[model samples]
Target chain A: MKRSLPLAIVFIGGVVFFISYFVPHYISEEILQRQIMVEWIKVISLFAFVIGLYSLIHLHVNKIKRKVDNWQYSILTLSGIGVMFIVGILLPEKFNGGIQQGSIYDWIFMNLQVPLQATMFSLLAFYITSAAFRAFKARSVEATCLLLAAVVVMLGRVPLGETIRSITQGFLDFPKWTQWILDVPNTATKRAIMLGVALGMMATSLKIILGIERSWLGGSE
Target chain B: MKKFFLNIVNLDRRWIFLMVAIVVSVPLFIPSNPPIVPARPVQELYDFIDALPEGSTIMVCFDYSPDSLAELNPMGRAICRHAFSKDINVIGMAFAWPSGSGLGQEVVSSAAKEYDKVQGKDWVYFGYKVGFAQMIIGMGKDIVKTVQADYRGESLKNMELFQEVKNYDDVSIVIVLAAGGTVQTYIYFVNTMYNRPVSAGVTAVMAADYYPYLQTGQLIGLLNGMKGAADYEKLINIKGLGTRGIPSQNWAHIMIIILIVVGNIAYLLEKKQTK
Candidate 1:
C-alpha cells in the first residue's frame, strides 16, 4: 500500500497528462490535475535541494569538528554557500533592476562556475582528438569512410580550409561540405538516437502510467 | 634518448593535461586571426526571427546559467536583438531556477533597451515559474497562475503586456536558450503539448541530440554552441561575443588537432616498438 501510493500518482498523472495532449475537452481537468501534481513535486524537490544543502553543510562542519586532513577546504566551501544564500535572500531586487543582477550569485556563478565548467568541457576536445587519432584507423572501407568524415569535419571547420578555399584551386567549398556532414551524417545519427529515445521514453512513460515502473519512487515493492 | 622520451610520452596523463592547458589557455591573451564559417542552422534560426510578424509574442526562456554563457549567451543576445528589432513582444521567464530569471532578464532587457523599446509597454517578463515541466504546462493553461508575480514579486495582473495572453497560444514563438535539461523539458512539455514550434540555443554536447527533433520538425530551429552563435552573428551582421571568441577557438582547435596527431603517433610508435 505504501509503495502503491506513489505508483498510483505517477500512473494517473502520467496517463492523464499524456492523454490531454490529444483530447481538447478534458483539457482543463487534465491541466488542473497536472498543476496540482507539479506543485507537489516542486515542494518535494525544493526540500530535496535543502537535503543536499544540509549534506554539504554536514560534510564540511564534520570535517572542521574532527580536524581532518585538509580541513581548510571545508571552510572555503561552507562560507561560499552561506554567503550566497545570505545575499540571495537579503539583496534588494532593484539593485538588479532591469537587469536581473544575479548580484553575488551571478558574480560567483560567472567567475567560479563558468570557468570550471568550461575547463571540464574543453577537456573533451583533446579526448575526442586523441580518440579519433587512435580509433579512426582505416582498416576497412567503413573505417576509411569514418576517418574521411572526421577529417573533413575537423579541417572544414578551421581557418586553413577557408584560406585554401580562397586560393581558387577548385578543391570544394568547405562550408558547403561541412553542412553536408552535419545535415546528412549527423542528422542520420541524431535521427537514430531519437528513434531509440522515443521508444525508450514511450515504454518508460507507459510503465509509469501503468504502475509497472516505480524505481523512481524508491522500491516499488 | 628517443626510447626514454617515448616511454615518458606513454607515462602519465598529467603531462597531457599540462600540454592541453597551455595549448588552450595561452592564446587567450595573444591576438589571433581565424576565418569563421557561418552555418545553415544558425542562419535558419536568424531567418525565423526575421520572418516573425511584428508584435508577435516571443517567449524567451532562460534555462541556462552563466556557465553556459560562453556558448549560449551570444545566440541569446543575437536572438534578443532580432526580436526587439522586429518589435516582437517578448514574454520572458526562467523555467530553470531563481538565478535563471535574473540572467535571462538581463540578456533580454539588454537587447530591448538597445532598440529604445519600453519594458512593460513593448515586452514584459513573466519572470520565473517554479515547477520546471509543470511551469511549462501551467503556462500552457494560464501563465499568471504559475507565475502570479514577476521575479520582483510584481503581480502579472498589473502588467499591461500580458493582459491578453491567457495561455500558450498567446506565446507565438518559444525559444529556449539553454545548456542543459531545460531544452529537453521544454521539448517534452511545450513541444509535445501545444505543438509549439520551440527553437533552441544549446551547447554542443546537446546539439547532436537535437537533430532528431529538427528532422521531426519539433523544433523550428536551433543555434548550437559558440559556433552556432558565431554563425548567427554573421548572418545578422552583428559583431559580438561569438565574433570576438573566434581567434581563441581557432588556436584552441589547432592545438587540439596537433595534440591528437602527436598522441596517436606516440601510441602507434609505442605499439610498434613493443612488437
Candidate 2:
C-alpha cells in the first residue's frame, strides 16, 4: 500500500499537469493553473520550509546533546535563526507589513546577510588564482591551445583589453576577437551540451512519471 | 636553473594570494578612468532599452540573491536608471529566491528616488512568490492573480503602473537578473510559452553557458557579469560603481594571466630538466 499509493499519486499528478499544459480550456486554465499549481503549491512549499526548519533544529539539537565535533557552532546557527525570528515577530506592524523599505528585517538583511554572503563569494577570486596557477599547464597541444584561448578571453573581456587595442591602433583588438570566440565556438559547444542536458532531463522526468525512478520516495520502500 | 624552476613550482599559495590582493587593492586606492568599450551583447541591451517608446512598461525580475549582488546589482541599477530616464514604467518582482525581492526593492526604490520617480506610478515592486516556474506561468496568464500585492503589502489591483499590465501581452519586455537556473525557467515559461521578449543579466561564470539562448534569439540581449554592468554604465554615461570597479577587474584578470603564463613556463622548464 505504501509504494502503490505514492506511485499512483505521482502518475496522476504528473499526467494532470502534463495534460493541462496542452489543453487550455477554463478547467485547465483557471482550476489547474491558478487554483492548484499557483495557490496549493505555494502553501505546500511553506509547509516544506517549516519541515526543513524543524529538521535543521532537530539535527543540531541532537548534535549538541551528544557533544559531537563542532557542536558549539550549532548553537550559533540556532541562535542566529532564533534571533532573526524574534526580531521579525516583535517588530511593529508598520515595520512588519513587509520586509521592505523601512523594516528592521531589511536592515539585518542588508548589513549582516548581504556582507556575509558577498564575502564568501569574493573568496572565489583568491582560490581561482591559486587553482589556475597550479593546474593550468600547457603540457600538450590541446592544453596549449586552451591556455592561449584562456588568455585571450581573460584579456578581451575587460577595459584594459580595449586600451591595449587602441594603443596598437586597433590592429590588436582582443575585445573583437573575444566577441567572435564567444559568438561562434562558445555558442556551438554550449548548444550541443544544452541538447544533451535537455534530453537527459526528459528521460529523467519520464522515468519519474512511469514510477521507474522511485529514489525520490526515499529508503528501501 | 633547475633548482630555481623547482622553487617556482613549489612556491606557497599564500604568496599568490598576497600578490592578488595587492593587484586588486592597488587599483582601488589609485583610481584611474579606464575606457569601457561596450561588447556586442551589452550594446544590444542598451539599444533595446533605448528604442522602447515612452510610457511603455517593462518587467524586471530580480532572480538572484545577495551572493551575486556585486555582479548583478550594478546591472539592475543601470537598467533601472535607463528605463526610468526613458520615461518607461517598470514592474519589478522576484520569483525564484526570497532574498531577491528584498534586494530588488532596494535597487528599484533607490533608482526611483534618484530619478524622482514615485512608487505605484512610475514603478511597482511585487516582492516575491514561492513558486518559481509556476509563478512565471501564472504571470504569463494573469499577473494580478499570481502576485496579489507589492513589496510594501499594498494591493496591486488598482495600481497605475499595473493598470494596463494584465499579463505578458501588456508587458513589452522582461529582463531577468539571475545567479541561478531561474533564467532558464523564464526562458521556458515566459519566452517560449507566451512569446514575450526576454533579456538577462548573469554572472560571468554563467555567461558562456547562456550564449546559445542569445544566438537563437531566445534571449534578446544579455549583461554578462560586472564587466557587462560597467559596459552599461559607460553606455549610459554614468561612470558609477561599475565603471569605477573596472580597473580592479582589469588588474585582477592581468594578474591571473601572468600567473598562468609563469606557471606554464615553470612546468616546461621542470620537464626539460627532468628529461
lDDT: which candidate is best? 2
Most accurate candidate by DockQ: 2
Q: How accurate is candidate 2 locally (lDDT)?
A: 0.88
Cα lDDT tens digits for candidate 1, B1-275: 45654664554565565666676677677876566767666766777888888878888888876557678778878888878888888878877865566567777778888999887667777656656777777677777766677765678776777777767787777898887767878888788867777888888778877876777778877887787888888777798888777766666666665655555566667767889
Docking class of 1: acceptable
lDDT score for residue A177 of model 1: 83
Give the local distance difference test score of model 1.
Answer: 0.72
TM-scores computed on chain B for all candidates: 0.90, 0.97
State the displacement of the C-alpha of residue A150, model 2, in Å, after optimal TM-score superposition. 1.2
TM-score of chain B of 1: 0.90
- Where does model 1 exceed 4 Å of error? A26-45, A90-147, A168-170, A217-221, B1-8, B11-34, B97-99, B126-128, B268-275
TM-score of candidate 2 to 2 decimals: 0.97
Show how many residue pairs clash in every candidate, following the order shown: 0, 0
